[model samples]
Target: MSRYVLERVQLSAQNHPKRHAAVSCAIGGLLVAATSALSVIQRSETVSWPAVIAVAVIGGGAWAAAMAVFVVRLQRRMKPLPPETDPARVRAARRLMRNGELGPDPETNALAVRMAEQLQSIPRWKKFTTTAFLCTTILGVLVTAPAISDGEVGKSVFYGACTLFPLLMLTVGRARLDRHHRNAAEIRRAAEHRTNTEAER
Candidate 1:
């Protein structure tokens, strides 16, 4: 039973890369929104707090709503287990999936488990990086606000970098993940084709 469930988990992880990232994106979006709101509070003397909060709420809510739509679409697009797949495995997979534990586990093959662990760690690492980024951004803004009053151009440039670097890093990371998934898909297709040709021969 566990074996079958693990197999299904592995299948989903390999086939549904986009779905795995959905929750992560939601987390990041919320984090960014919170930080932006905090930044507003920090600059309340210079900025209109009520107006900034209104914009943040509207923008963040819209972004979150859009992401929710994307997640629903991705879920619908996920391919079900093939007709030839074992009924018991399918049932177990569906149960575990409903509970949201569809990643590889200790019972899975060691090599595959290691790979899954590595992939799973990425989100954890991202969470840590997001926290660090938030702290850095906040600190930069605080430092720069004081310097801006003193007319320090160097501090202003650093503040701009602090704001943009985290976003740039996230974009690059997402691009890399997309490329990795594309390559994985190509390899899977080629392997399937080769196996089918050999079986026909």
Candidate 2:
């Protein structure tokens, strides 16, 4: 069980991806708080301030953790980079050699060109860093919502983010991820074509 809990948090393509980052960060934050609470099961010092602190610690820590994860990942994901390498290089190279011409790509430049092309199509960081920011912000509100005297703040925060943030990220990421994936598929095709072309040459 303990192993399972940790396993869920380990970094993966799913966890690292921008679209999932917000939820992962939010859950991670909450998980931290939950872990702190487990200390009580072992101790006989139940029914005291310690219990309160433990719960508070867990919840608060989770909230903080969620915030950090989203911000960092968002920043990194958004950075600009060169294009991906297309497999077409070797074949293209052979073709160029046979024709006694050099243009567009040298062996070294092929990979760079691929990466440059990819970078041109991806989204920026500010566009996707909603991970901790949205998730923790939501968790923070939900954590505080019950304390609202007349449910005023609860309603305000809940509708504001639960609906707003997710909707915004979903709408944007839906398109962005789609494009990113499409570009990746294109790159893969380019690679295959490159390889096949090289073989033919």
Winning candidate number (lDDT): 1
- lDDT (C-alpha, whole model) for all candidates: 0.54, 0.50
Q: How would you encode candidate 1's per-residue C-alpha lDDT over 1-201 as one tens digit per residue?
A: 364665555456445646644655567667657756765665555777687777677666667667766555544444433434553544543343333333343222222223323333332355677677777667767767886787867656656676667656666765666554444344344445655887999
lDDT (C-alpha) at residue 87 in model 1: 39
Cα error, candidate 2, residue 146 (Å): 12
Cα-based lDDT at residue 78, candidate 2: 42
Taking the candidates one at a time, how many backbone clashes does each contain? 0, 16
TM-score for each prediction?
0.42, 0.34
lDDT of 1: 0.54
* Candidate 1 TM-score, C-alpha based: 0.42
Candidate 2's C-alpha runs over 4 A off are 1-56, 60-159
